[model samples]
Structures are given as structure tokens and as C-alpha cells.
Target: MKLIKWLRNILNYRKFNCRRRALFSLKCCLVCKKPTKRGCNCLNGSIDKGTASLGPCLAIIAVLLILIVSFQYIIQIHPHLVRETSLSTAINVTGVFLWLFVSVLFNHQSCVWISPGYAPKCTDGYSSKYQNVPDEYFKYDPELKNDETVRYCKQCQTEKPWRAHHCRVCNRCILRMDHHCPWIWNCVGFRNQRYFYMFLFYLWVGTFFFIYFGYNRLFELYKVSSCILTFLPTIFCKLEENKIVVMNDNSLSWFNGRRYNDENQWFMFCYYACCGVNAVMLTFLMWNSFLLVNNQTTLESFQNLNAEMRKTRKNKKLRHFKYLYDLGSAQLNIQQVFGSKYYLALLPICYAPIGNGLLFPLRDQVHQIVFADTTNEPPNTKHLKVVTV
Candidate 1:
């Protein structure tokens, strides 16, 4: 390849500029034949598969369709939802559309641009020092707990903070990472976690808002569509001839499908789909809240859970579970993620975390136990790790 490039350069005999390159190689040949390639590079393959079980393409499609179809369907069925003047219906529909717009903007930004806190370049020195520690040191040894600082990551070629962990999809260590949320196409980390949770909150609210009033209309729509007692199947009769289908430019009526479009069935489908997605997002939001309130991250929870299980296997004794990061109270734990002010948790406003992402407020007793045995010098204490007990 180098020789080909060199010979081509010499034969061209022109200055190393864009215009010369475009004219030379083709200008020499009487016949200009070009073979253009399309689609993804064969060697590079696709990163979407590795990012999550549900690929990026599918996730993007799902997000867009829900945003559009749900709102359109909601407008069509607004009368059934809000029993008031047409002006009130317009306002309600406008609210749903505006909420969805915000969700899409932040969700797209979260997935494509946010950085998940990569380990810094200077951490290589810490990594070098960490390499000298014995392998058994990584194990949960109760006696050597306080000395287990400076975890070395082979992929990032640097040292990781106490709660930091490697994400194969992001291909780096993230500081205070919650999870690799594929839907957003980004890892939820220190910076964009606020956006991610906000997106979830809005999505839940928008969908549930539609469901709250539209539920009765949806049930009636479903009831009219099916009739086992009817002598013939739906396909056997001319749907138009049945005259049961109705459409109105002004009012809500039963089983009204448009001339070519089955409006009733389509509306039902959209409502049910939105309801299901809202349910999933609601569950995810609650789980995220639980993690935030307990002062635990998803990755940390996994490690702690596995460690507990392993200990149980050896001892085979029944024991109650405990949280190492728990601040001994739910309110303090919630403040750790949201802010010192309690109300910040309820709003989506941007607030800088109290800790600068490096140091954190550990439980008072645990903090003392972890650092008690160490001396107060950089050379002596920099390698000390936080012991989670």
C-alpha cells in the first residue's frame, strides 16, 4: 500500500493539494473507471449489536414512532379524554406535544454526545503503582480492605476511582456510571444522568396523561371490535356495508373508520402501544429512583450483590442485606445524587453535585474505618482504597 501510494504520488508529479489529486489519476488514463462502495465498511462491522441486545437502529425507530403516532392519535380522541370546550381539548393536546418535544431533544443529546467520564491521562502513573499489588488483593479480603485503592483498567490503560467500573459498550471507565442505556445511545454517567432521568419522567407523564382519560374510550373501542356471538367473522362481511363503522369531522361516535383507513382500530392500537411503553418507562424510573435514594449505582449494586452471594455460598448462613453506601437514612442518600436541597430531586433543573465527582461523602462510621489505619501523606495514603462493608 505504501509503495502504491508513493508511485502514484510521483507519477502525478503535482503539488500535494486537493485539486491536483482530483485531476491527475484519472487524467492519465484514456478511460476513467470508478468503482464506488456503499453501506458500512466490511471490516468495521456494526457497533450497535455490541451496545445492547436491542440495536440502535431499532431503538431510534421506536423513539420516533411513539413521539409522533401517540400525539396524533391523542388529538383525534381528545374529546373522549377531556369533557369540556374544544379550547380545553386543544390546550391538553398541546401539552402532550410540547412534553414529547423536550423528551426527544434531550434523549437524542444524551445518546449521541454526552461523555461518560473517561479516566484521565495522568492516571497512568497510578495504574503503574497499582500493578505492583498482588492478585489476591482484588478479592474481598476483610483484613486488606483499606489498602485496596487504585484499580487499574487494562482497556483504558489507567487507574479507576473507587466506585468506577469498565463498560464494554462505551469502551472506557465511567465515573459514577449508572448504566449503559442503549435507548439514549449513551452511558448514563456523572454529566447526563439528569437528562436521562428527566426524559424518562416526561415520557411517563405524557403517556400516562393520555391513558388516564382515554382508558374508557379505549375499552369501548376494544369491546366493539370483537363479537364471538356474531354469526359471521369480521372478514366475511363488507366492513362498509356493516354500517357499524362511523366517522365524523366534528363529534365522537362508535366504530368509525375512515373511507380507506381503519381509524378506530388504528387509534386503539396507538393508545395500547403508548400505554405499554409508558408502563416500561415508569418501572425503569422507579428502579432508578430506588438506586438514587439508596446511594448506589447499577454497576456497584451488581458487584455488591455478587459479593454477598459468594460469601453466602461459603458460609451458608442466613443473613439480612445491608447497604455499604447507604447514608444510614434515605433522605441523605437522595441528597447525594440530586443535591443538598431536597426539592431539587423533584425538578429537572441542572445542579452541580456537591462533591466534585472525585471525593464523596461516605457514611461517617465507614469513612473512619477505611482511612483510620493509614497515615496522612500522599505517598503513604494515595494507594489506599475505600473499604465497603
Candidate 2:
């Protein structure tokens, strides 16, 4: 009985800790001094600080349900060839399954790296010791006294680069911090951004493929229904009555009309069906491509626009596409978008965060070489240059 009471007490304590941690982590908006709420415009004077309203969630659920039902219907209605030819049908079906598998795998592996504390000491020549000084150097100009001391990260105790921001969630200072991604469960920092981008690209492609296959199946089902209707007893009865009235080689006339009319109807049905499906798939694919080209996730794009509009005070206008033209010229260019040093170290893909897998390893090697002398020397004006690339 005593042991049971002790176990119950321990469980209650754990539950209290969990609630306390959660409340502590709930961030307050810097502008409002209130707990930050998602999908809310507290910054714009809307004070409904509850969780996300059911409207958007319901809409998303409706779309997913519709897709699921439509896919099931198509599969059941057309167990055979959706494409006109057997080979084309087989290829379409195979492509759909393969793309689905790839999409699921990519989504599962998405993650970002974060440094919880101070960065490791620079072994490589890429980071200059002098660069550790704060931006006060630039702000005060050369005439001002150089009072800015190099600040080492309290956690990692290593010198951080300019513009590096500490990610509270990641518990580390990320170089050129963009944002944290919950899907990957990591900070979208210097590394893994490429994989994230590629993952988005592949997902868009796979969705297009699935839609195409679904469309063809829908078309085939429609054609089959029309064909059955055209060759029905009602049509045959009308033809028989006309033949008897004409009474001059009616059999041959009836046979020729049925054969030619049925063939033409089926051909037209198949052609139109293909056209409709292709158009819908093409439109959706273009939208996904547009998102990728801008290097913004759908969620980020929406949030950034919301923030921008709030600042401008022109909330009436919904000009989301205005930012597209500024894509390549933005501070986060294609090179920085893909060429993060950390990503090169972790992921196998060489597309972005360029260079071999040895980048991080080489960084370590260089750090060891440079810091080998442990003797403490008085701070001086000497500059140490480390070539990273």
C-alpha cells in the first residue's frame, strides 16, 4: 500500500512538470506582451487568442476527404485500362506508386540542425578571429574607440559569425538563421535546407503524377458509361422501326450505322477525357512550381505576407505574387539557399551546401591545427585568416 502511494505521487509530480514546461515555452509576442497565438493577428488588434479556429482545419479536412473518395471511386470503377493503350496504362500506374513511396520517405526524413549553446572553436581558416567583434564596429565608425570585445557564445564558447542568431528551440546559434521547421523537427539553419527544398520539389512532382493517374482513370470510367448507353436496347428499337418503314435493304443500313456511330462516339469520349485531366494537372503543377522557385514554404509565404501587410496598413490588398520578382535578388540567394556549410556535412546529396562530405571534417582538422598552441597570450591587433572554401 505504501509503495502504491509513492508511485502515484511520482506520476502526479511528472504531470505537473510537463504542464509547467509547456506554459514556460509558450512565447509572448514582443509587440503585445501576450502569449503568442497562431493564425491570429494580435499584432493587428484581433484579440481572440484561442487555438486555430475550426474553419481552416475543416476546409483542409474536406479537401482530403474529397480526394480520398474520388481516388477510391476511380480505382473501383476502372479496374482495367485507364489509358487507351495497355502499355501506357501500365506505365501510369507504376509511376503513381513509385512517386508515392518516394514522397513518403522524403517527408519522413526531413529535419534541421541546431546549436543549443556556444559554437565549437574554429579550427578551420574560414572564420577570422577578428570577425568575432559585434556590429558596433560598423555602427560607430572608425573615429570611435574600438571598445567592442569579441563575445564568445556562452554555451559553445566559440566565436560566432556575423548575422548569426541563437535559436532558442535548437539551443544553438545558427548561421544565417531562417526559421525552425517542425516537420523536420530541426532548425532550418546553415545545413539541411537543400534537402528540405528537394523534398518539397519531389513532393510537388509526386502529387502531379498521382493527379494525372487519377484523371485518366476517371476518364476511362466516363467513356465506359457512355459506350454502354449508346449501345442500349432503346437505340436498337428506334433503328428497327426506321428500317421497317424504309423497307429497302434495311438490314444493311442498320448494321452500317450502328458500327460507324458506336466507334466514333468511343473515340471522341476518350479524346475529350484525356484533355480535361491534362489541363487540371498542369494547372496544379504550375502553382507548386511557383512556390519552389521563390524558396518559400507555403506556410512561411503566408505568414510573411501577413506580417508585411500589417506593417504597410493596407490590409485590403492581397498581392502575394508581388514578392516573386524579388526572389533571386533577395539576401538569401540561390547560392546561400542551397550552399549552407552544415548541410554539406550531413546529407549525401551534393546539389547545395556544396562541396564533399569532408567539409565539416576538414573544418575540424583545421581547427585542431590552428588552436594546437594552448598558451594564453594577451589580446593584440593581429588578425588570423582561415580560408574555408
Candidate 3:
């Protein structure tokens, strides 16, 4: 009886151990926990360290190849374009445009590679750190019954700072996030937003200049046989008043030999394709310009539209909507992107914006009402209350 009991006890212990090991293995994978492309850990909070989709990379490479081919054909058509005064102007314009475009493009790419920063983790007193922030940024949750003024990201298991949201693709919380742009293959957030704007500005200007300068080469190729005059078969055709005649070797060519195809048709096709890309770039450039002027992120712009739609639908009337952060001046808005120095805005180097990414500057008399605290004395001094160490 004792030998049978000992064997049964040993078997039960082994079964328990096996179950524990199986559960541990399940928890190890990111998919088991979150079931998304984003991995367990993200770099610099927002930088996606995981494998990227090949689609965006291939698309970018294709555009570059087309541009190179266009340049090659342009040179082939106009060998003396570098020396000719009119053509030289195109060369100079394209050269400078390409330089600036490449400079900002890589700079923006670096921004994407860099982390947008992570929200503070909730464990080991990290969650308590954000509680000291100003009332305007974080509201006191009365439901907690502890008067703790803080918010948390459930998925990240971390303390979420104001304006911080978790990006599922990257699997981390981004601060002051703009949007996830697959074109750049990264998230556009506070740190990289400046570089992004410069990239767009240069790309728009450069591509437009390219289209204008390269127009002659493409147009000349397409206009090779635009004016046509057909003669009747075995009939003597002539005009009375405006009698003019042009001779062609069509009859002789049929008897002899003929080259049916020419480079003109292919050049025309390439021109149309380039024009199509330029058109898309032009449209996006305008949209980005509108966003910069309005001091809004791509994500915020979409959110604002949705909110306005919902509001209008609910009220059954169209009403003028006001944005909270809009300082009501274009210069101020532009300053947020370009920084205070005028020259820095044009350069590709990194320049920090006026305020920290966390606490953004606001228009006068707006925050006083929005963050009115009953506990704090002296109602007018509420602005001073915003200074949270």
C-alpha cells in the first residue's frame, strides 16, 4: 500500500510541473500576450525595432529609379543642356532642389529611427512620478478616492503622460504623436515632426521644379507627329487658296523597309507616368501645408474631422468649430514647427521647438477656465499652478 501511494504522489508532482512549464512558454511570446505585429519591447518607445513590411521600401525604390531614368533621358535628349543658358537654369534648379530634398529626407528618416520616448512604467514608484504634473494636463480621478492625479495605459502597463498614446503597430506609447506614416516606415511624433515638415516642403518644391524643368524634354518627345496631313489613295489632292504641299516617303517606305517603332512613344509614356506621381505629390503637399498652418497633427486633423461630423450630425446643424491649441496666428503656428530662428527653419539640422513636447504653450485666458481647480486658492494664480516640477 505504501509503495502504490508513493508512486501516485510522484506522478501528480510531475504533472503539476509540466503544466507550469507550458504556461510559462505561452507567456514568453508577444503574440500570446498582445497578438499583434508589435513585439513585447519597442525601441525608444515609438521606434519600431521589429521587421518592417517590404511594400513601402519597394515603392520608395521604384520612385527613385524613375527619377534617375528621367534624368538619364533628359541628359540624352539635351547633351548641351549644361552649357545652354535656359537649360543651365534648369540644371542649377534641379541640382539645389535634389541636394535639399535628400538632406531633409534622410534627416526625417533618422527621426523615425530614433525613439519618440516611452511613457513612464507603472511599477516601482514610476506611476507616482506623473501625479505631480499640473492639473491642466492631468485630472484628479475622484473615483480612485486617493486624490491621485494620473492616467495609465492598460496595454503598456505604464503611466501615460498627457498627449501620450500607445501605437499598436510599434507596440509602445508615443508622446505628442503625429501619425504612423508607412511611407517613412515609422511613426511621426513630437521629436521628428520638424524634420517631417522640412522633408515635405523640400519634396514638394523639388518635385514641382523637376516637373517644370523636365517638361521640355518630355513635351518635345510627345509632340513629334501632332500635325497630320493624309493624302487620298491614287488621287491628286490639292488646295486652291492656301495651296501648300508636303512630301513624304510613305509609298517608298512600304516598297523598301521601315522602322515601325521609335523612342518617342516610350518617352511619351514615361512623361505621363512622371506627371501622375507629381500630381499626387502636389495634392499631399497642399494638405500638409494646411495642417502646418492650422497647428495640428495628421492624427488630430482626422480626429477633429470625425468629432465635427459627429457634432454636426447630433445637432443637425453646421456650426463653426474652434481648436483649443490654435493660437490664432500663422507666425506662432509656424514657430511651433520651424522654431524661433528664421534660418533654422530652412536648414536640415535638428532644432528643438519652443516648449517641451509634454507641456505645449497655449493662448491667453484659455487654460484658466479649462483647468480651474477648486482646491487651489487665488483663482487668477491658476496660470502659475501650471508649473509642475
| TM-score of every candidate relative to the true structure | 0.63, 0.39, 0.61
Number of the predicted model whose TM-score against the real structure is largest: 1
Better of 2 and 3 by lDDT: 3
lDDT of each: 0.55, 0.40, 0.52
Model 3 worst lDDT run, 10 consecutive residues: 233-242
Model 1 regions lying over 4 Å from their true place = 1-49, 52-55, 79-86, 89-97, 100-108, 124-149, 219-222, 225-263, 306-321, 341-351, 376-389
Candidate 1 lDDT, 52-146, residue by residue in tens: 43435456675676666665545555655455447676577657666665665555555445665554534333355354443332232211233
Model with the higher TM-score, candidate 1 or 2: 1
lDDT of 3 by residue, 1-389 (tens): 42354355445544444444444444545336553233223222222322233324643664564466445455433443454447677567556755755664566565556555555554343445444444444442211113344656778886655556777655677777777766665677767777766766665565555555555555333333322334421112221122123356566654333221234445444445546666776787788778777777776576456754335322112122344455567777767666668467576566565544545555544444434455653233333322321
